[model samples]
Target: MKVIKEISLLREALRDKRKDGSTVGFVPTMGFLHEGHQSLLKRAREENDIVVLSVFVNPIQFGPNEDFETYPRDIERDEQAAYEAGVDFIFYPSVEEMYPHKAGVSLIVNSRTNVLCGAKRPGHFDGVVTVLTKLFNIIQPDQAYFGLKDAQQVAVIDSLIRDFNIPVELVPVNTVREEDGLAKSSRNVFLSEEERQQAPAIFKSLQKARALIDSGERNPEKVIAGIKEELDSSTSGEIDYAELLSYPELERVEEIQGKIIIALAVKFSRARLIDNIIVEI
Candidate 1:
């Protein structure tokens, strides 16, 4: 597995690959290896000739009071996982290398960013789209892969490609979960033992919400209430946001119809976890 840290070197490598007709599949991530990230790498490996994994903790995407400085990082372990997953290249760039001069321009996908995680963490998606655009340009991949855990993020990237006419194909991989149904995330590391035990309630609540919707319960209020109630019982869990909204669009829907997304975020002692389930009704 070759590791490239400089932008020019990475771009030159990509140009050479294109000349050789090698299809590049890129997985851009904020380091901290987990099974969910591995799933993305595996899928990228299967579909493309060369799989490039980037491990840069984007400082722009993190807001003040957020865990940007303290976010997990283990390049040694992540490289092992990526290499075993058949990744071809690892682009490990420094913050200065990524944003040499203050990023004068930003790629803003507005309407899509005004809800969910966006509403809570302002400018979150902007930072995401901005860095992703930079990575796409630098790597010049034929396709890019992202996990479906961040359903809202998937929507934003979808709009970004459509609106900008970027040639790269955007692939959405399914969310990987724990044996007990909790969505696997790097942030899961932040959960203390007690918090980890209570973490499953988030997924359990989603299951309850899905059941309510599947059983002909259409009222959004009722579904939301039931989910809230489940989390309310958790002595260690703190509810962040629980809503049943249209998948991708993220607008609140009164009656569950086609595909609706049940997304939730809860804070444990040290970590904030987000998960979602889609139901067709």
Candidate 2:
């Protein structure tokens, strides 16, 4: 696979492909390739004539004290993985290439920025939307793939695309998980051996929540309480939030009716892990 760093050159090449009537599928990611990322690329490969994967660790998407500097990255490893996942082009752009000028304007997400991960990490989605706007413009893919592990992120990007009238089709792929049920994440590398063993409990708690819901429990508080109890007994991680919110919209609900997401975030000794189960009642 060819790695193109310059935006102009990448666009030119993609434009040439378009002239040949090839459909392009894009997967945008922060480096540190994992099974979760590969799942998205694999789906893209199956659906489109050309698949483009980007590995730029976007600075704008990170907060002041976040792990941007220490966030895991290995371009060589990522390149090899992208090639194996059937990527046609790897858009490995530099920071300057992505953000050339001092941003006079930035995209702000006003609505869905007050709950779940959004509530804790302020301005995180804003950063996400800003960089995505730039990437979408440059790649100009017919379809873009994103995993549902970051379901809130998928919701935010859905809104962004609708409001801006972007032409790309946003494909929401299911979260890829380890055999033991933990959601696959790049941050999983930060966990200690013990922490890693305890990590699967996050998903287990979500499963407990789902069981409660499926057994005719409709109260949000009771469902969340049961989920907390499971987490309390199963792992030593500090609970950040165990919330049952309306699906996609992520608004608080009095009763767990219709489609909802039971989302959890826990802080292990070193790594902070998040997982969720979306259910329809």
Candidate 3:
């Protein structure tokens, strides 16, 4: 797989793939690739004629005081993983290449930025949409694959496409998980040995929440409370947030009905892990 660092070079590599109307699948990721990333890559390979993966750890999307500099990155590791996962080209751009000057215009996310993880990270999705707008124009992929682990970002992007008329299909892949059900993440390495053991409880609690919903428990408060209670008992990590909201839209519901998401985030000693289950009831 070619590792491209320039926009011109990237377009050159993908030019032939598109000249004959080949379908391109784009997977945008920050490095420190894990099984979760590989799952998205593998799915892209299955569905598209050419798979393009971008490994730029976008600096703009990270907020001040958010520890963006410490975000894990290993391009050598990611390169090997991408090559094995069947990526045709890796668009690994530099920050200077992506952003050369202070921006005069910025993309502002008015809605969907006040809940879940977005609530705390101000202007995060605005940066996401801005960079994504540039990437979408550059790659022009027929389909873009995103993991549902960051489901709120997916929701924001859904609005981006709808509101902007971007032609690419938005494909939301299921979150990849460990054998014990802890969601696979780059941050998993930060977990203490004991914290790692307690981590799977996050997903377990979400599973229990789904079971409650399936059992005809419709009240949002009851479902969220049960999820929190289980986490409180099973794990020592501080519960970051456990919320029930309408899927994709992510609005609160009076009662759990139709498509809904039960999402959770937990702060371990070192790692902050998140997981969610979406169900239609």
| Superposed Cα deviation of residue 269, candidate 3 (Å) | 2.0
- Candidates sorted by lDDT, descending order? 3, 2, 1
Residue-level error in angstroms, candidate 2, position 206: 0.6
Q: Per-residue lDDT for 116 in model 2? A: 92
Clashes of each: 0, 0, 0
TM-score: model 2 vs. ground truth: 0.98
TM-score, cand. 1 vs. native: 0.97
The segments of candidate 3 whose C-alpha lies over 4 angstroms from its true place after superposition are none
Per-residue CA lDDT of model 2 for 1-281, tens digit only, reads 89999999999999988998899999999979999999999999999999999998988778898889988999999999998998999999999998889999878999777999999989999999998888899989999999999989998999999999999999999999999999999999999988898889898888888888779999999988898888899788999988889988889998888889888899987678988889998
Q: In candidate 2, which residue ranges exceed 4 Å CA deviation? A: none
Model 1: per-residue Cα lDDT over 1-281, one tens digit each: 98889999988887887887989999999988799999999899999999999999999899998999999999999889988999888999999999889656667767866667888999888889899989988888899999999999999999888898888999999999999888999899888888888888898999999888878898999999999999899747777888788877888887889888888888788898999988877
TM-score of every prediction relative to native: 0.97, 0.98, 0.98
Candidates 1 and 3 compared by TM-score, better number: 3
Candidate 1: worst-modelled 10 consecutive residues by lDDT: 103-112
